[model samples]
Target: MSPRRHRGMLLLVLCWVLLAACTAQPTTEIAGSRPVDTSARAMLGDLRTLDPCTLADTAALQRFGAVSNAGIVSLDYCLLHLKPDDRTLIQLAVGELTGPDSDRPGDPVVPQGALNIVQNAPVPGHCTRRVRFGDGVSLQVSADLLAGEPGAGLCGIADAGAEAVAGAVQQGRAGHRDFPPNSLALVDPCAVLDTAAVNQVPGLEEARPRPSVGGHQCSWGEQSADAPRVQLQHTAGEPPRILHGAAVEEPVDGRRTVLSVVGGDPQVPLCSAETGHIPFGTVAGQVEVAQLVVAVPGETGTDACAYARGLARLAWPNLPPANP
Candidate 1:
């Protein structure tokens, strides 16, 4: 054989041999391994100036009016929200890590193995803080501890890591605006998994984060078309810290019109609305969904509700009620 062809064959054989060894070995070494630090508090300060939407301290959550919002503070929670349907696989992986029989020999399922790494490997503490916004958005941030590793836990890590990287990039592009909507600005979870070399799990297709837009698209979408409206409202006794928004689906002539009205003082945009859309073929083969995002900015106090209501009214005319 020609020298170049011989080298190619040798390389291919080496890959096959490595694959065989991985397949033959059992995944028992990772279970109940020494616990790694995965705390969110440790990383909070570093990320504070990174994104205005994130609070450096839990106590500061109140200042941002997150008391009644759905709080998210763990890498696990963040992964769940970012990819809700993959909860079972992720939880199973965590269970394996925490379980007594983790080292016991079994089939080398990819998802379970990936979860084991996340549960056992250490991560910065500050990435675990839960932030809630009462309305529709809640965030729990964490670093992807196992980006280049192979195995079950690798899948989740790749997905979450890509998301974190994507989020950071998108936020940077948006200049850290307040109340950003959930745009598919993160890397494709599936592509991340595929590149990470953890594609052996059954039903792996279901665990992937499909893109809403087409090839080579940026991770995040553009800013909302309408300017955010701000409002502050008072309750009976509590030191008010509540933010609210509505994401309602309105169907129009065989099409869906999604109207999102967000209300808060100093409203922090979580994800961009103009850029957020469900991926094609994610839900029963649907390709795209229309969305409208409106921000209501300012700090919390009296008149917040009134301002929100007015904005909703304005949006109502744009959407109109769906026919029965």
Candidate 2:
């Protein structure tokens, strides 16, 4: 063969070799590789007596790791730990669990959605509720009756017996209005409380400290009251539009300042962003409560108070000391 033709034949042979290697690769979707084990599923049946939170903890993961790998599934308790809000809980439980090779398509093993509805039902006092997640696990949730912990009582449990005591420590602490009754819906409980923290004291615009980023000035002010507290305002645009009645309070424990952003007329949207990024003129605030820090995004409004309040709650301390 001519020199040019020989080179061309060699290239063709290499291309064919690469194609064979690609086609020989194993297919990721193996039918019985991760088969659902009925025996493992039976083990989870008795889990109804255990606490959902406890089952979701690291210890539970360790205990059930083998079974989970064997195809005995459970809910993604980590996501539930992130935001214990009932709505978020319901969404996560009902939504898909994404990660690893465990893409088994089905509802969560714990039926949290049904339990959420029962918890919100207009019954007086606390109630115990039970939900089956799927083939593997079940959840026994003890919902509080009133707003706060002390006032909250276990009303009843639907599927599980009331006497069943499951020791599921909440993976993460609950924030303000994290799990409010159904009638109340989910209001930013921190709205009123945080507003008070941010606008507690006058001259916050001046006395507050500033955090410098690049060359721009990032100023911070605080207002706080009771459980809710608002961090200093960090605006990147024109002077933030002030809202009426928002107040700031003296710092508690000398570590954090509190702000109270009240609700009502001229409601504002805090933490507004046109795209994913907060706009140049947008304002942001943090509310630190317990273990969660809520980020409030600024929005367009005659008054920036509502957004301020939301931001304050979102940025609440992870484990703020109780008000004295």
Candidate 3:
């Protein structure tokens, strides 16, 4: 085999092996930084400048990697990237509390008041760790290496770096940044649709973000015609949302399902989906979910509601989820 091809195969094998090792090997050897006493929720808000690319102390850590930040920081997460090279880099995302304590393994966590930190199972060319800010939020950090040349020491680097960042957050230390004006403006609305799901509805084949009577809604329809389209809109109001708390279904019928289809207007066939919060990403504060509406003149109610549920499945996962 050519030298280049041989190297590629070897790297793939190494990654598979490392990932398997990460599955359940909990370690106590992980180190901790100075104790930080703070709530995860409060830290998230103080992370006023949530740029990971430029951390508070990037100058001292030139030995390993330079800093980089990718996405906007919000109440849910602040994603970070530390680049040592193309083949090796590190990532960290501080997230809100996901669920009960059983979500992660019971590893030794160095308690810094409300802060909780633990090393997670490793992934290919990566070492993952968790730093729970008090009881309500978590800091997920990972070290990534594309090739074995970067070596196995990545886990340690990921762990120490995560601990330091977690502490920095607790102490209200973050890079200077200008926060966005609207809280729910961070995520791309068009990115949430299931390509396959939207295509199943005839005429309503294209999906794009557009404003409608109900505020900012995503529309899927023929570029040539306006009717015969399915759209998902966001409305924050009181209860009785069409598909509120309804399980996702196919070929949504007016008779049987989690919610009997809201058959109020013959002109607009629609359903409702409520945003209940276990964890809502960008749509956390949203109270009600308006079902996908099919407004094609000749379309059946079944097709309209089906398109709504299909679109709901795609959109629901992206919304800040209600409680699990």
Candidate 4:
């Protein structure tokens, strides 16, 4: 209660405050004191048909070193390799959609017109930055140093790549993918099955189509709910060899359909039907495949394969002819 004790306590508090301030992690602050406009993302156009490679601006990335296209990783991503010392690889994902429920807590945003660029936490030997569009869609720039390569200034390269992507989108240079008329690339996954066809499955009676970021995939109803849900994706790969359950092979209008139920639990399993329709040629042995899946929940004891076969039959007539 004396003046001496009061003075000492005040000094102690001041020291603690200073220490905390020095150790505090920096929070995200928007550059230029401005927020991005979400509407500008509309220029990117329909995600399914948009060519993600267009956003990888090689000119902007050239400052770091030589830039080379790594090719399409998926319908939603275009990969690029950056050579700074000729061994350090920078793989950039142009546009990968992260839904609203994602848990990534991104740091400081740099506003580029309508885009908000953010630097994500780096893992060992790797760094990533993202151009977030507020709607859970993002273009990520990643720099990974190969073994025995130095990691110094690795994140700086990611920042530069992210800025380049943002600039490309802002300048309206983003482009769309083109495919031949008879190619399966033109098929919309959402249109492969109608609402009525989806409703025929239990739990999706009132479900509607939710298109994936690339529009090459589609889903109906929530997977975790008590009802069964359906998902269809257009991809290139050989059909999976069914393991754990009956591997029923059937023909739908000459299309080879393979059906199987796979999961650890018998009450709830993933019923799938894979059909090959066209040639993709990415790999000598790979072909364009339509993967139709039905996830049954709880103890519904639904005839998953039967429904899968029915859906395949319904979808087969609509799919592009094989090898066209």
Model 3 residue runs over 4 Å out of place are: 1-37, 46-57, 66-103, 147-152, 174-183, 186-324
lDDT of 4 by residue, 157-253 (tens): 7887788888888788888866557555668878877879989877778888776555566778763434467777665444334444456667866
- lDDT for each candidate structure: 0.23, 0.24, 0.43, 0.62
Model 1 lDDT per residue over 1-324, tens place: 112212222221111110011112122234668532222212222221123223222232222122222221111111121222232122101100011211224423223221221222324311221121111112223322212222324334433433343244323321221211222222222231121111121222133222211111111111222323221110011111112343333333333333332332224331112111232212242222122222323422222333323333333233212231
Candidate 1: 10-residue stretch with minimal lDDT: 231-240
Superior by TM-score: candidate 1 or candidate 3: 3
Tens digits of lDDT, candidate 2, 253-278? 33333233323123332221100112
Candidate 2 versus truth, CA RMSD in Å, comes to: 25.3
TM-score for each candidate, following the candidate numbering: 0.20, 0.19, 0.40, 0.59
What's model 3's overall lDDT?
0.43
Give me the displacement of residue 52 in model 4, in angstroms.
2.8
Clashes of 3: 17
Return the top candidate by TM-score: 4
RMSD of each: 23.1, 25.3, 17.0, 16.3
Q: After superposition, how far is residue 14 of candidate 4 from its true place, in Å?
A: 49
